[model samples]
Target: MPHFVLPVSEVLVVADGWQAEPDAEAVIHRAIATAAEIVEADLGEAELAIMLTDDAGMRTLNSNWRGIDKPTNVLSFPALPPTGPRGGDNAPRMLGDIAISYETTRNEADDEQKPFDHHLSHLAVHGFLHLIGYDHEKDDDAEAMEALEQEILAQLGIPDPYAERMD
Candidate 1:
């Protein structure tokens, strides 16, 4: 069988709080790999970045980029498509960037009664989907996106994150 190549991800821990989760980077890498495989993204040479930050950093990003003054669990900034010709044959495609807030994610996991890693995986998958143009702007879009997320998470042995909401 042919080997499938997933995108190369660079994880940056920007906040000291993220140190509490030692396996955070590994969880993100696994989540992104699984998500890329499920989506069948042609990202063999593509690269993306994940930023693990705290609520304050996230608040600044949210406010500056989205004009929202609150901190969110995760945010994705999709890279704009390249307009000009390729610079080189080996130039890796720039996928985009994902930012996750440690405090927000932890709080959400505690409130939802889910494992920290499981919730982190969900957020990572969610952020990866956004990087690939999967959005939840509309009702149908949200349903589709959520279904995909559930599928990806299931493959990772995680329960349906939306199970509670559907009830």
Candidate 2:
């Protein structure tokens, strides 16, 4: 198991613009660390940034970066390229930033009838995978990514996020 410790300082919970559960930070760190373990990523001295915002902020970001003026649950901005070879064992990789919208996430959890922490963990895993060069742009890719997510989440004691929708 990789070092899953996410120092409280490494995460920035910006909930002034939105309301997030008190346990959001813990769930975020656990999700990301689980992902690092799944990918065998060496997280030596590496740092990650998480900004907890709401629908307005997410909509702005989605429009600015993805050209879709809508609020999504999470967005990942990877600091490294997906195609190149990774660094050595001693090297630390800046995983990049993950912005999560409280409103969207809460709504999604309610709609899916999933626990908030579980859904948040799933999104964090999903976003971390994107940072590490995972994509769901095609059917095969989606399957592979989702499988990885399910495995990773299971390690975190979380149920399959897609189980309800797989039917």
Candidate 3:
């Protein structure tokens, strides 16, 4: 019941880069489905956006929003407030947005020797988890979140993303 809205932003794609690796719509849709199943998100009353961009755009967003000067692999901007009621039928919840750095993801996948699709799926899952209020700010939090991620990825035929380094 997951609904995905992948709006093409003013994002550039490097030739043969991560942006060119996977079919954009298919990748986003798969990620959305996985996330919705994991969180039991009310797809009828929920909306999420995913933006695929390059490192430069992501750096600007990260610096402006997070005060970080460098571009990271993925950034999640959850729309949920810190304190709010769980759910209601009155409105569709804005699950916020996810921006992924196509450049960084490609480079990381090359460096780590992981399939580009696998990496993309991992990041999408990571970003979607954030929308559902999952975080890795501490040991316990990281453990819980990572476990869920692993579970979801496994269900999708993706290998353990943290199996090698346990990070």
Which structure among the candidates has the greatest TM-score? 1
Better of 2 and 3 by lDDT: 2
Q: TM-score of each candidate? A: 0.97, 0.84, 0.81
Worst 10 residues of 3 by lDDT: 5-14
Clashing pairs in 2: none
In angstroms, what RMSD does candidate 2 have relative to the true structure? 3.8
Residue pairs with clashing backbones, model 3: none
lDDT of each: 0.94, 0.81, 0.76
Number of clashes in every candidate structure?
0, 0, 0
What is candidate 2's lDDT per residue for 1-167, written digit by digit as tens?
33553322156766663444888888888888777777775445566678888898899999999999899999999886435766466454567888999989999999989899999999888988887779999999999999999999999999998898778
Candidate 3 ranges with C-alpha deviation above 4 Å: 1-19, 41-44, 80-91
lDDT of model 2, residue 162: 83
Model 2: per-residue Cα lDDT at residue 166: 73
Report the lDDT tens digits of candidate 3 across residue range 31-101: 66775676665445566777788888899999999999999999999885526666555655567888888
> How many pairs of residues collide in model 3?
0
- Rank order by TM-score, top first? 1, 2, 3
